[model samples]
Target: MKSEKSKNGLYSHFRLKSSMSFLMALLVFVFSCSESDDGQMQGPEPVMPPETSMAPDMSMFDDEGGEENRVNTIQNWAYAAINVGVYSSILYSHLIVPVRAFKVTINQEAHFNEDAGLWVWEKSFEVPSRGTFSVRLTAEVDGTDVSWTGYVSKSGVFENFVWFDGTSKLNGESGKWNLYESPENPEAWLSNSWEIDREVGNGNTSFTVEKEGNHQGSSITYSIEKGADYDRTVLINDVSNSNLVEVQWNKESKFGRVKSEAKYGDEMYHCWDEQLQDSECP
Candidate 1:
């Protein structure tokens, strides 16, 4: 027979042990059902922009084609190409260098922010054409879109210029990009808003550039599509007058056509030879 004091002590010890076992089992169940990243998981990075070759690389319509080049001929293609070239200039001169800098993930490092649940890429890089720049890219999940932003600070120059921002599908089927004016032109910084929309799985993209804040007379839409007779097709919309300029060309043959009612007075397609001179359509 055990003493009363010994029995009481044994009872208390077994009771405490049973409570501990139940507490541990409850903790195991909670953690099993609700596993958290605890701020350690790396988020997804942004996708690289569509190819810039989406813009046609054609010489200016200065000589040869003349007035016929100006209108009523394949010159409509020249005219539309001219506008696209302008937007290309803005992108290459002010915005492209930074985008090219951090897009490569091979050597770039991405830091994950647990609090914000974002993946940030920052780097200082030099372009042979342009000087060095500090570029930062951030990406986070937003509904069905992966929201991303790009900020650039030139070396020994201005800091924190939000050169661009946009969102893409998590699977990268499509997206839109908004570009701002360079910090050098502060008066128009963020005043310039251009939109880029990518077609789903078709390898095509359309860019609409708004002039000043006006979309009536000066807006231009440039798009690229794959074609049958031609390897590539380009469509440019003169949004003000609701006119469409279409260019179809073979990449190797370098022959193409331009069709527009605003420029040619008819929707008939006009052809240009390999030399980009006026020719009869087939």
Candidate 2:
């Protein structure tokens, strides 16, 4: 028969083993729902079509206008048109940085966030001449609609800068991205927000720049149609003067035209040649 001291030692050993088993089971339970992709979720990151596919090519006019005397000075028509063109190009140029940050995840790996039950693609890196940035893209599927969000953070600058959030069909045929300007542009148009509606593979995209608060009714509509006659187009609506100024051009040849009801005093297209000098319409 065992002595009483030996019986107590046996009990202590049993209790220690039982406690360790319980701790191990608890750990397994906790990690069972941890973040890891194991073939039970959607595919890779939501498709982010290249920005160049829709970005307007207005650089053709970079070499035009601003000439005092070019033997082509009809009301400085080309100059007026170039002003509008410059504005159009600048509107979207600011967004390229953040947009590209989100696109970098296209070839990278993403893990399923089991806690959130969503596929998350996130990155933190430095962009040459753009400083450092962190971007997150979350995608969820509810029915045929794929809701995607692009959130960004700049080190020592800002966090949760929602660059864009929009939805698209599962097939990626059509969608719209609501784009917001970066904090770097402190003087951006007051309460300004941009919307881009695109039909992928169709070369169809529309842009709308809007302002809120005290600057109401100052919205502008612009577009770029690749195969159309006037491929580069910027339409500015002057609500105060009840005028419409349009700037259009071809990317390859830089041949373009402009017109404004208020300034021009008539409905006629002011033409410009390949050299961006004033030209008589044929």
Candidate 3:
């Protein structure tokens, strides 16, 4: 009877220990599952998108209407006239012989007509021994060309002159001008002027003048060619007739030279030095 009781006690103890171990395992599994559920309740991390850029505003370049275009055209015409008129005054005043050494001051006035959309500019200057010179330029709205008129008064005599763009006839004379540009040299430009059948002393005369220079520098060179009948006199001086004349000058140095061979055995070879004094040709 004692042996049987001991066996029963041992069996009961083993069964109880096994039951407690199973309970512990069940508790551990329940806790782990609860933690997993908590994680599932929270959604996936937020995904960031890429940034984008904005386009530029191009409204400033757009023309609002035809008024802006018209205004721009008028402004361009006026500016071009101013430039050409100023240069022409300087060329005729300082580049030509006889009065090449004189000092000149130019006064300019500009006006615009809003109703007619026209631009007019006047430049006046005095040349020693030559009297007063006035140049007037007029341009219509959107016109491709400008009309120029010049007047000179000396002593008591007044003379009127007009310039021809080579395509137009002025004073029964046809004159033309050509502007040249060099593709290889951006600083170089040349202009040539020609006139045929220009009334002079007794008959008509033909003349040509070429100006070549680099705007980047202060030096310019000119070549003049002329042809006229024996009975005809030159328009410039009326003293002599010439076939060819060459001139060169440095505006910065305020020095220049001229060489000419006249038809009547008169030859002119002069150089204006930096001192503004006439000197022997170099």
Candidate 4:
């Protein structure tokens, strides 16, 4: 009987040990599975931000800037040709340089900021002396070549001295301004009433009939700084009562239509030079 009891106790101990070993193994497996699942849930690899490039150095472009570029890069006018001159007369020397009329390679693409608003037609020209000059510009406005003309009523570089004799006869007015042409040339005219407008440095000046109505006759006499003995001409014509009248330059003279430049650090009358860098004009 003692031998049988000892065998039963040994069997029981073996069975109990096997059950505890199995439970320990199962807990270890569960912990390992939980750790693996947590690692997978963390997500994909992180992405780094892109690096930025340094700013470029701009000193090279500054070296090429100069007055020549500013002067030559004048906004070319959009037209076949521009007509500029002073009226022909002895009072105003008849300096005639024919206006070369030609079209640019491209029309609308050529423009500059002289006025600093919308681009307007611009050109570069030179006169031999200083005097009163008139410019009659005919350009293609709205794709149509219409003559939109204006004049420089005063003197400018390469132009000096001016003597203009103009006459006007009003419908009801009495005596006219008896004007005479000086430096007498082939063309001359005598007038009763005349008006001349002059503009100095910053102040721009223009002239026209004061009141537009039934006027008898009107004339314009341009007096340049230099010219023949009496090279004066008159543009006398009768017109119906209207504010808008067709006027002409008494003579054809050379005019300088340079590109407009920035007017910095100055007033209109006392501002910068044509290029607007500094006062280069003497």
Best by TM-score: 1
Task: Name the best candidate (by lDDT).
Answer: 2
For candidate 3, give the lDDT. 0.33
lDDT of each: 0.59, 0.60, 0.33, 0.26
RMSD of each: 8.5, 11.6, 33.1, 33.3
- How far out, in Å, is residue 108 in model 4? 11
Candidate 4 deviant stretches above 4 angstroms: 1-87, 90-115, 131-235, 238-282
- Higher lDDT: candidate 2 or 3? 2
Clash totals in order? 0, 0, 2, 36
Ranking by TM-score: 1, 2, 3, 4
Candidate 1 residue 42 Cα shift, in angstroms, is 4.1
Off by over 4 Å in 2: 1-45, 49-54, 63-114, 123-130, 181-201, 213-226
Question: Which has the better lDDT: candidate 3, or candidate 4?
Answer: 3
TM-score against native, each model? 0.64, 0.63, 0.24, 0.16
Give the alpha carbon lDDT tens digit for every residue of 156-258 in model 4. 3322122221212221111122112222331223332322222211111122222233433332222222243212222222233222211111123311122
Model 1, residue pairs in steric clash: none
Q: Write the per-residue lDDT of candidate 3 for residues 28-105, one digit (tens) a residue.
A: 887654334334321111111000000111111123235544245333222222322333343443333112211121
- Candidate 3 residue runs with Cα over 4 Å from true position: 1-107, 113-117, 141-147, 151-156, 163-282
Better of 1 and 3 by TM-score: 1
Evaluated at residue 156, the lDDT of candidate 1 is 74
What is the C-alpha lDDT profile of model 1 across 128-241, one tens digit per residue? 677788778777865557876777888678887876677777655566666665676533322222223445323555555533654423333433344556656556665656
Least accurate 10 contiguous residues by lDDT in model 1: 187-196
For residue 155, what is the lDDT in candidate 1?
60
